[model samples]
Target: MSQSVHMSVLLDEVLTALGDIKDKLVVDGTFGAGGYTRAFLEHGARVIGFDRDARVKPYVDAVSAEFPDSFQWINRPFSEMAEGLADVGVEAVDAVVLDIGVSSMQLDEAERGFSFMRDGPLDMRMSIDGRSAADIVNEDSAEDIAHVIWLYGEERKSRGIAAAIVRRRAEQKFERTLDLAEVVERALGGRRGAPVHPATRTFQGLRIAVNDELGELERALEVSEAVIKTGGVLAVVTFHSLEDRIVKNFFAERCGKLPSGSRYAPEVKAANDPTYELVTHKAQGPSDAELARNPRSRSAKLRAGRRTAAATWSEQTVSGKPSTNKVRS
Candidate 1:
């Protein structure tokens, strides 16, 4: 497959992790290009896919025609999968697979403003509606922008970039992707020895904030816990550390593995039952062949788990709010 396309990252690992989904109902949480869903359908599983992007309808329509009664597409965010699926008489699914982060298609289409590589309108709304990147850069205070950059992108020079953005926007609002990118790059001292583009982190932070990606992932994990049947499987592929960390921590929490608090604190059993068992003890990375085939999959990590008979932790799935500005100490 051409690397230019949305080549499914860790497709083999995901299929292996899912074991046998034949004749089972599976949920593709992020059906960007329908890679995972198509694979599941070919494996004899009925698929219910979810995506906020309406542009994916044509691609999904073709797959739906092939599968006929075996496939269904829900044009909604994965966070609302539980409620949305319920409306269509899908109470639970046997497996849930999510491929997280900005899609290849979104990045390639400069009009979406997801990539800093090409100049485009500064509109990075995942759902095609809501607060945009331009809104944040133009309206939010420098402090707020810095907080988002530091929290989402883990950029050390977030303050400098935010300050520069505020200064530049005062003259003319950042209406284009290249305008913001250039400002951020200049703030970071023209890249110097940086491995990636200087504006990559800034663009990533803006995109995450504009789409509320972290919040969506956090809420979606809870929804997966609620909607997946006992013995069901959950396979997630995340592109970066921030996304991987959430999945790792969520799996740890659900498996009854308590975090090591201070030495002063004693270990106590969880009040609720453990809802998931570890499928892969640790996250799986793309293989050498996959790397050669698609360099973009370099940072991808796949983590999978199996649901237990224990009740869902409906009230307390995550530690705090979904869209947290929590800076890791």
Candidate 2:
């Protein structure tokens, strides 16, 4: 049998924030390969694991048989978790943990089309329901293609890469992962001396676009805050700066810092009482040892918040709602 894939970044810290899980119902929002689920079960936590990828259900099923009545796995996006669990009459949860982004299993499987190192179909949909990356690459207008690459991948040479893609597709459409990777490599003049692959950012961009990852993540955060009970722990392990920023801002706004120039003046009505108590004032990153074990973890950032005992629905509790300043449309 193949060795189990390791989860990237802050795996230990995430579980720690969850507290003793004995009999406490928790939601493993990402459910990618069940790494967090396994740990939660071992700690005697009752878990409802959710993943958009139906393939994970088999593994979850196996675990359920081993620990009957302790685990429930749902093959659907975490965004729908609230409703999925409601069928069984679960209204609120004790904790919700979301490890966002692609899993090691997705990248390792050559047929999954998530990695450039392994040749696969250009499909990058995590749910298998949305349009594939291949569709975007071969059919999107140059401007649209460039926008996805630049906005999601942060690739500086997005225009050049998009132009090359359009030129190549005119002859033959992109059918495989490496086919697009090669074009990105050539346009970027190759990574020659760099340890990272030249196409890393391009692939990241494509996957984000195909999955609409950021938008989903933002929604999940909001929904989680609403559904989790007061004193619940909300932990998120993000693999990129963009993901980290959203988590950071969400918690900061919930904590409700005073507006500038208000320390001496009568407090401006304290807009909203704090919901989550910031667990770590700043975000946490992987340790050096972890970095050595998994280079993919280098970019990972973990931010955690504990729902205050007085926590309330973010918008309902607060008089006004905070705006989600998304970088992309």
Per-prediction TM-score to the true structure, in the order listed: 0.92, 0.90
Pairs that collide, model 1:
none
Tell how far residue 254 is off in model 2, in angstroms. 1.2
TM-score for candidate 2: 0.90
Q: How would you encode candidate 1's per-residue C-alpha lDDT over 115-135 as one tens digit per residue? A: 898989999888878999999
Best by TM-score: 1
- lDDT (tens digit, per residue) of candidate 2 on 1-329: 12255463587878777777788889999887777887888898899889999877667767778778888888778878778778778878888999989988889878889999999999988887979999999999999999998999888999999999999999999999999999999998888898889898889999999998999898888778767777778999998777887888778777765444556774333466676788777888888988888888888888888876444545544636543222101
**Model 2 misplacement above 4 A:** 1-3, 258-270, 309-329
In model 2, what lDDT does residue 131 have? 94
Measured on C-alpha atoms, candidate 1 has an lDDT of 0.87
For each candidate in turn, give its C-alpha RMSD to the true structure in angstroms.
Answer: 6.0, 5.4
